[model samples]
Target: MSDADDAGHRRAGRPLETVLTRPRITAAALRLIGATGYESFTMSGLARSLGVAPSALYNHAASKQVVLQWLQDHVMTMVDVAGFGAEPWDTALRRWAWSYRDIFATHVPLISIMAVLPVTGAPQTLRMYETVAAGLASARVPTAQIVPSIVALESFIFGSAFDVAAPADIFETGALAESSPIFSAAVRQGEQIQGKARADVAFEFGLEALVDRIGRLRRP
Candidate 1:
């Protein structure tokens, strides 16, 4: 074909549509947060990273809070809620708790935001809750107690995520060791324990206690 004819045909083709989408926005938001942290994250910054104007982002998400809610839901997808129906209640709870703590350990920055964020519009987050609630209900836990129980586990998991990110010598008393011998010695003893991480040990110990208490809530 002639170059002129080819150019005319190309001009007649459809204009390229904007590829912006919720998943793309969610991905870009996460990348932005990982690079600059939540403190610096902004709708304008997200648009910059995505190669679009801030108005384009607003087309999918109304506000930064809404974007964060979307991010929260996206992060929830990484957690292992499948065990709820497949495993025993206690076993499922343990699996879910470990997965939750581990996933959030790398995402400690999101914890404060997510802790207070409601699950109302976050479908994945709500789905996770539904699974846990169903498992607890199947174990015969009172309907009214289900939400509180889940909240208790989440409180522990969130705290544990922070603990996981803490330095190994987070308990180090150093120059003050002589002033607080017992606590210092306990810290040293904990350090001396082999194999598992201090965070894992503490999480397991606390999880067992919580599970024991929650298990007792079941009707005979």
Candidate 2:
């Protein structure tokens, strides 16, 4: 065929769509984890789920951990930090903490991965830290205390998020109820509190205490 005919034939064909990219890979990895737990996660498995060869994934990601890093960065982008600029530090932190907790409560698998992962190449994660740091500084918290404060807050948030995922009967004393009367009675009382999930109620209780303690840092 002549060059003109060949060019027309190419134009008549449907446009090819991009099959692999950082976003696509991140999404696929999250779905795989949600469906089969991270224990079953693998680069080959992800590639199969994405309808591509295992080698094709390497063009975008170096390893499974790299994809997980991408997922971590993407997840951080979901946290709400909007109150940081406009609200008092306490208010802003409450908003951010609730958002952060809610996300990881459902993403328990990622909590450990993110806790130990460095922020070197994670832009969204870095942005989150920057916002919180600036908010703390704005509230007159000492620069030296900012990092430590962040670490402490994150530790609580991670623990709270994990708690949110525990079985509903986690607090149940079972056959040992008679041995732990006071604790069992309180658990029963907590179950009677209306309108909120027990985990949420507990999280709010801790969040309030944390906010109070952190706010005190700004005072003499």
Candidate 3:
């Protein structure tokens, strides 16, 4: 073929720019979840948000579950596990719990999704668990109790994360206030006596209590 004809053929076969990548896809997926939430987050919606065909997402992820696993691992990378090796076990647990709850407070949807999802393929998530488990073992917690204790602590953290988003008047009894005067008064008192937000104060209280209880479980 002539040089001009060869150039024309090369141009015809040139691939389109690769706009979709794992990072970009994950970012777009997170934005879609943030904007529309888990209930409305579908592969089709994600593709629409990324301005690509749904087939493009499939090129990166096999299914919605796979994308969610990627998101879970990415999110796990944000949780604070720095205290595990440097601080006392209790202190490390406290630091990790606070960071975990804070990160998930804005990602409540992921909390629900991840609650049902396993950690088999999520390496970051598994790393977090390993750190916490090692910390517990180092602290002399019973082998049988470590997993349950972790689960219990996580249950509190997840609930507290949701509570962080609750309105200040979430406890308002409205017309029923008069019927439960004691509870209403306590709520009002709690609102007034705070350096930290009420939800935070409650979280600290619960976390400390759990920590103390776990400490008592130490082997002799």
Candidate 4:
């Protein structure tokens, strides 16, 4: 009877720990920033979205940049490209590249910050780069080529992510039509393959092509 009463008491009590520490501000920031770029997304906007005044957010965050840093850190972790310690780098690199693409696709809205903002927060971007560099070292891809290779891979992946986020109108203005067909085709392609299959297929293709090019370049 006492145990039953204790169990009932426990059940009646709220588990407020998760509520007390609402650390998943990452999702909130990403959703807001992704949908409305940081420049225009205001405290009032966040409050409206959260069903609170512009003041409530102060409990969780101070500035938009804090929110941005939070989102950036969270997103980077979701992308598994950062390898740890010594191992054969090929699999890690492939995994990292593919993972990076998938996460970007998942957070296309949040990733726009990567353009002008300096990388910051919980997950260290430099550490990720260093980790990849260490992996390339194991792969015998040449000491001098390590940094360049990493930079190239990052540029390709991030550029693709940005392409996904950029508005079609940006590429289709009056003078922009000359290059708009490619964007038009890409839009069609995005519509055609707007699912897991699309991202997986394109990333795999690009990653393999890049690895091959790097391998050939490193050849003696």
Clash totals for all candidate models: 0, 0, 0, 2
Give me the candidate number with maximum TM-score.
1
Instruction: Give the runs in model 2 whose Cα sits over 4 Å from its true position.
Output: 1-19, 31-40, 193-195
> Which residue pairs does candidate 3 place in steric collision?
none
Lowest-sum lDDT 10-residue window in model 1? 14-23
Instruction: Residues 19-126, candidate 2: write the lDDT tens digits.
Output: 466877888888888899878899999989988788888877999888988998899999999999899899999999999998988788788889889899788999
Q: For model 3, state the Cα shift of residue 7 in Å.
A: 24
lDDT of 3 at 109: 69
Q: Show the colliding residue pairs in model 2.
A: none
RMSD of each: 6.4, 6.0, 6.7, 8.0
lDDT of 1 by residue, 1-220 (tens): 3546545655878321145667778888998888888888999999889877888778778999888878888999999988887999899999999999998997887788788877787788888888899999999999988988999999999999999989988889999999999999998888787578888999999999999999988899
TM-score of 3: 0.82
User: Could you tell me every candidate's TM-score relative to the true structure?
Assistant: 0.85, 0.83, 0.82, 0.58
Q: What are the lDDT scores of the predictions, listed in order?
A: 0.86, 0.86, 0.84, 0.65
- Tens digit per residue, CA lDDT, model 4, 1-220: 2545545655889432212123445565567777877668776686566655566666667777667666666677666854544335667777788678667765665556654556444555666766787777766788888878987898788766655555545533366556677876775676566655444455667878888877776545
